[model samples]
Target: MEFSAADPGTVRPGGRTARVRAAVLRAAGDTLAERGFAHLDLADIARRAEVGRTTVYRRWGTVTGLVADLLADMAEQSLPRTETGSLLGDLKANARLVQRTLADPRQGALFKAVIAAATCESKTAAALHRFYDTRVKEWAPCVQQAVDRGEVPAGTDVHEVIRAVSAPLYYRLLTCGDGLDEAAADRAAEAAATAARAGVYVLG
Candidate 1:
């Protein structure tokens, strides 16, 4: 099922509609973090949010649609990328941000649940892709600035460089189960920076 950002629950409105959305989304996130996606039900979420069942059903439609909007809201509410002068500094900052999010108990569990859902659900997968796309675009400019400053090759793949900084951190989060700390974040940033300097991310 194709999902559009322009869908009912995806758009951010104000007043009562916004409050209802916020409460429902908070409830949805809590459900995902605590019980995983399989247990997510619109009626249950409505009860949790103290909103009307008809309201939740009318606004979000299906669980997939609700999840899609939840992902969208997360992308919208995520903190903006930081600019730290140099590529290493900026990459380190980005890495640390990712590390902190994955280290948080609730956020980590929510991500794990969403990722598990994405594996089997095409709409969830699409929403997850969109979430990453938004984040990558937010951080990609730092790599471009590095290129302008001659810190990396002129044709370095900016998005890939950004992705590189977070890939290892995520690997540890999902599989290694090691300490996903700031030191690990620094190492990931350093590795990506070294690769970018060596033109590993340069477009052919």
Candidate 2:
């Protein structure tokens, strides 16, 4: 069966299939982090996953397809939005989560590899965009709730505010010059909260 970008979730398998897919994804993530997308080989993935080469080829079709499905799975498994009753609290929670993920050796390397691939591959870029979009949408309601509570002005660009909370954390991760520590997360949360209160993200 051919998997489309529009229906990545539909590629789910049952029992053995599910286990194989999970193994392949884990192997793919490790390979991508270690060797990058250009060097990714289905044979290597099959060997690492302990699945048959033919099965990998038949299921994923191409590297892009596999990456897309892996990203879709990540989206499905991502943590739900934080609702802490205040914009500052919610943003801090979000930033802290990002900091923790980026600080992890395996996850940080995997993200860097995926981002590097997305820069040159259109398919990977699209998948990356979808992943961030899913994450942003999930957290945007916190900003909206703040508006409703009169903590921030109405007509705030909730999505933009949410994005602002993570932008600096991602910047640090991609640059590799600094650590995305809890202090940095706190600063990001403070900056985004300050900006929102100052009408930086408010829409006229």
Best candidate according to lDDT: 1
For candidate 1, write residues 1-204 as lDDT tens digits.
011122223346678989899889989988998999999999999999999999999999999999999988888877778898999999998998888888777877888899999999999999999989998999999999999999999999999998999888878878975789999999999999999999999998
Q: Per-candidate RMSD vs. true structure? A: 4.5, 5.2
Question: Candidate 2's residue-wise lDDT over 40-136, tens digit each?
Answer: 8889999998999999999998999999878878776677777889889999989888888777776777778889999999999999888888888
Return the number of clashes found in candidate 1: 0
TM-score, predicted candidate 1 vs. hidden true structure: 0.93
As a TM-score, model 2 comes out at: 0.90
- List TM-score per model, in order: 0.93, 0.90
Which stretches in model 1 have alpha-carbon errors above 4 Å? 1-14
- Return model 2's CA RMSD, one decimal: 5.2
Instruction: Enumerate clash totals for all models, in the order shown.
Output: 0, 0
Give residue 12's error in model 1 in angstroms: 7.6
The runs of at least 3 residues in candidate 2 whose Cα sits more than 4 Å from the true structure, single-residue gaps closed, are 1-14
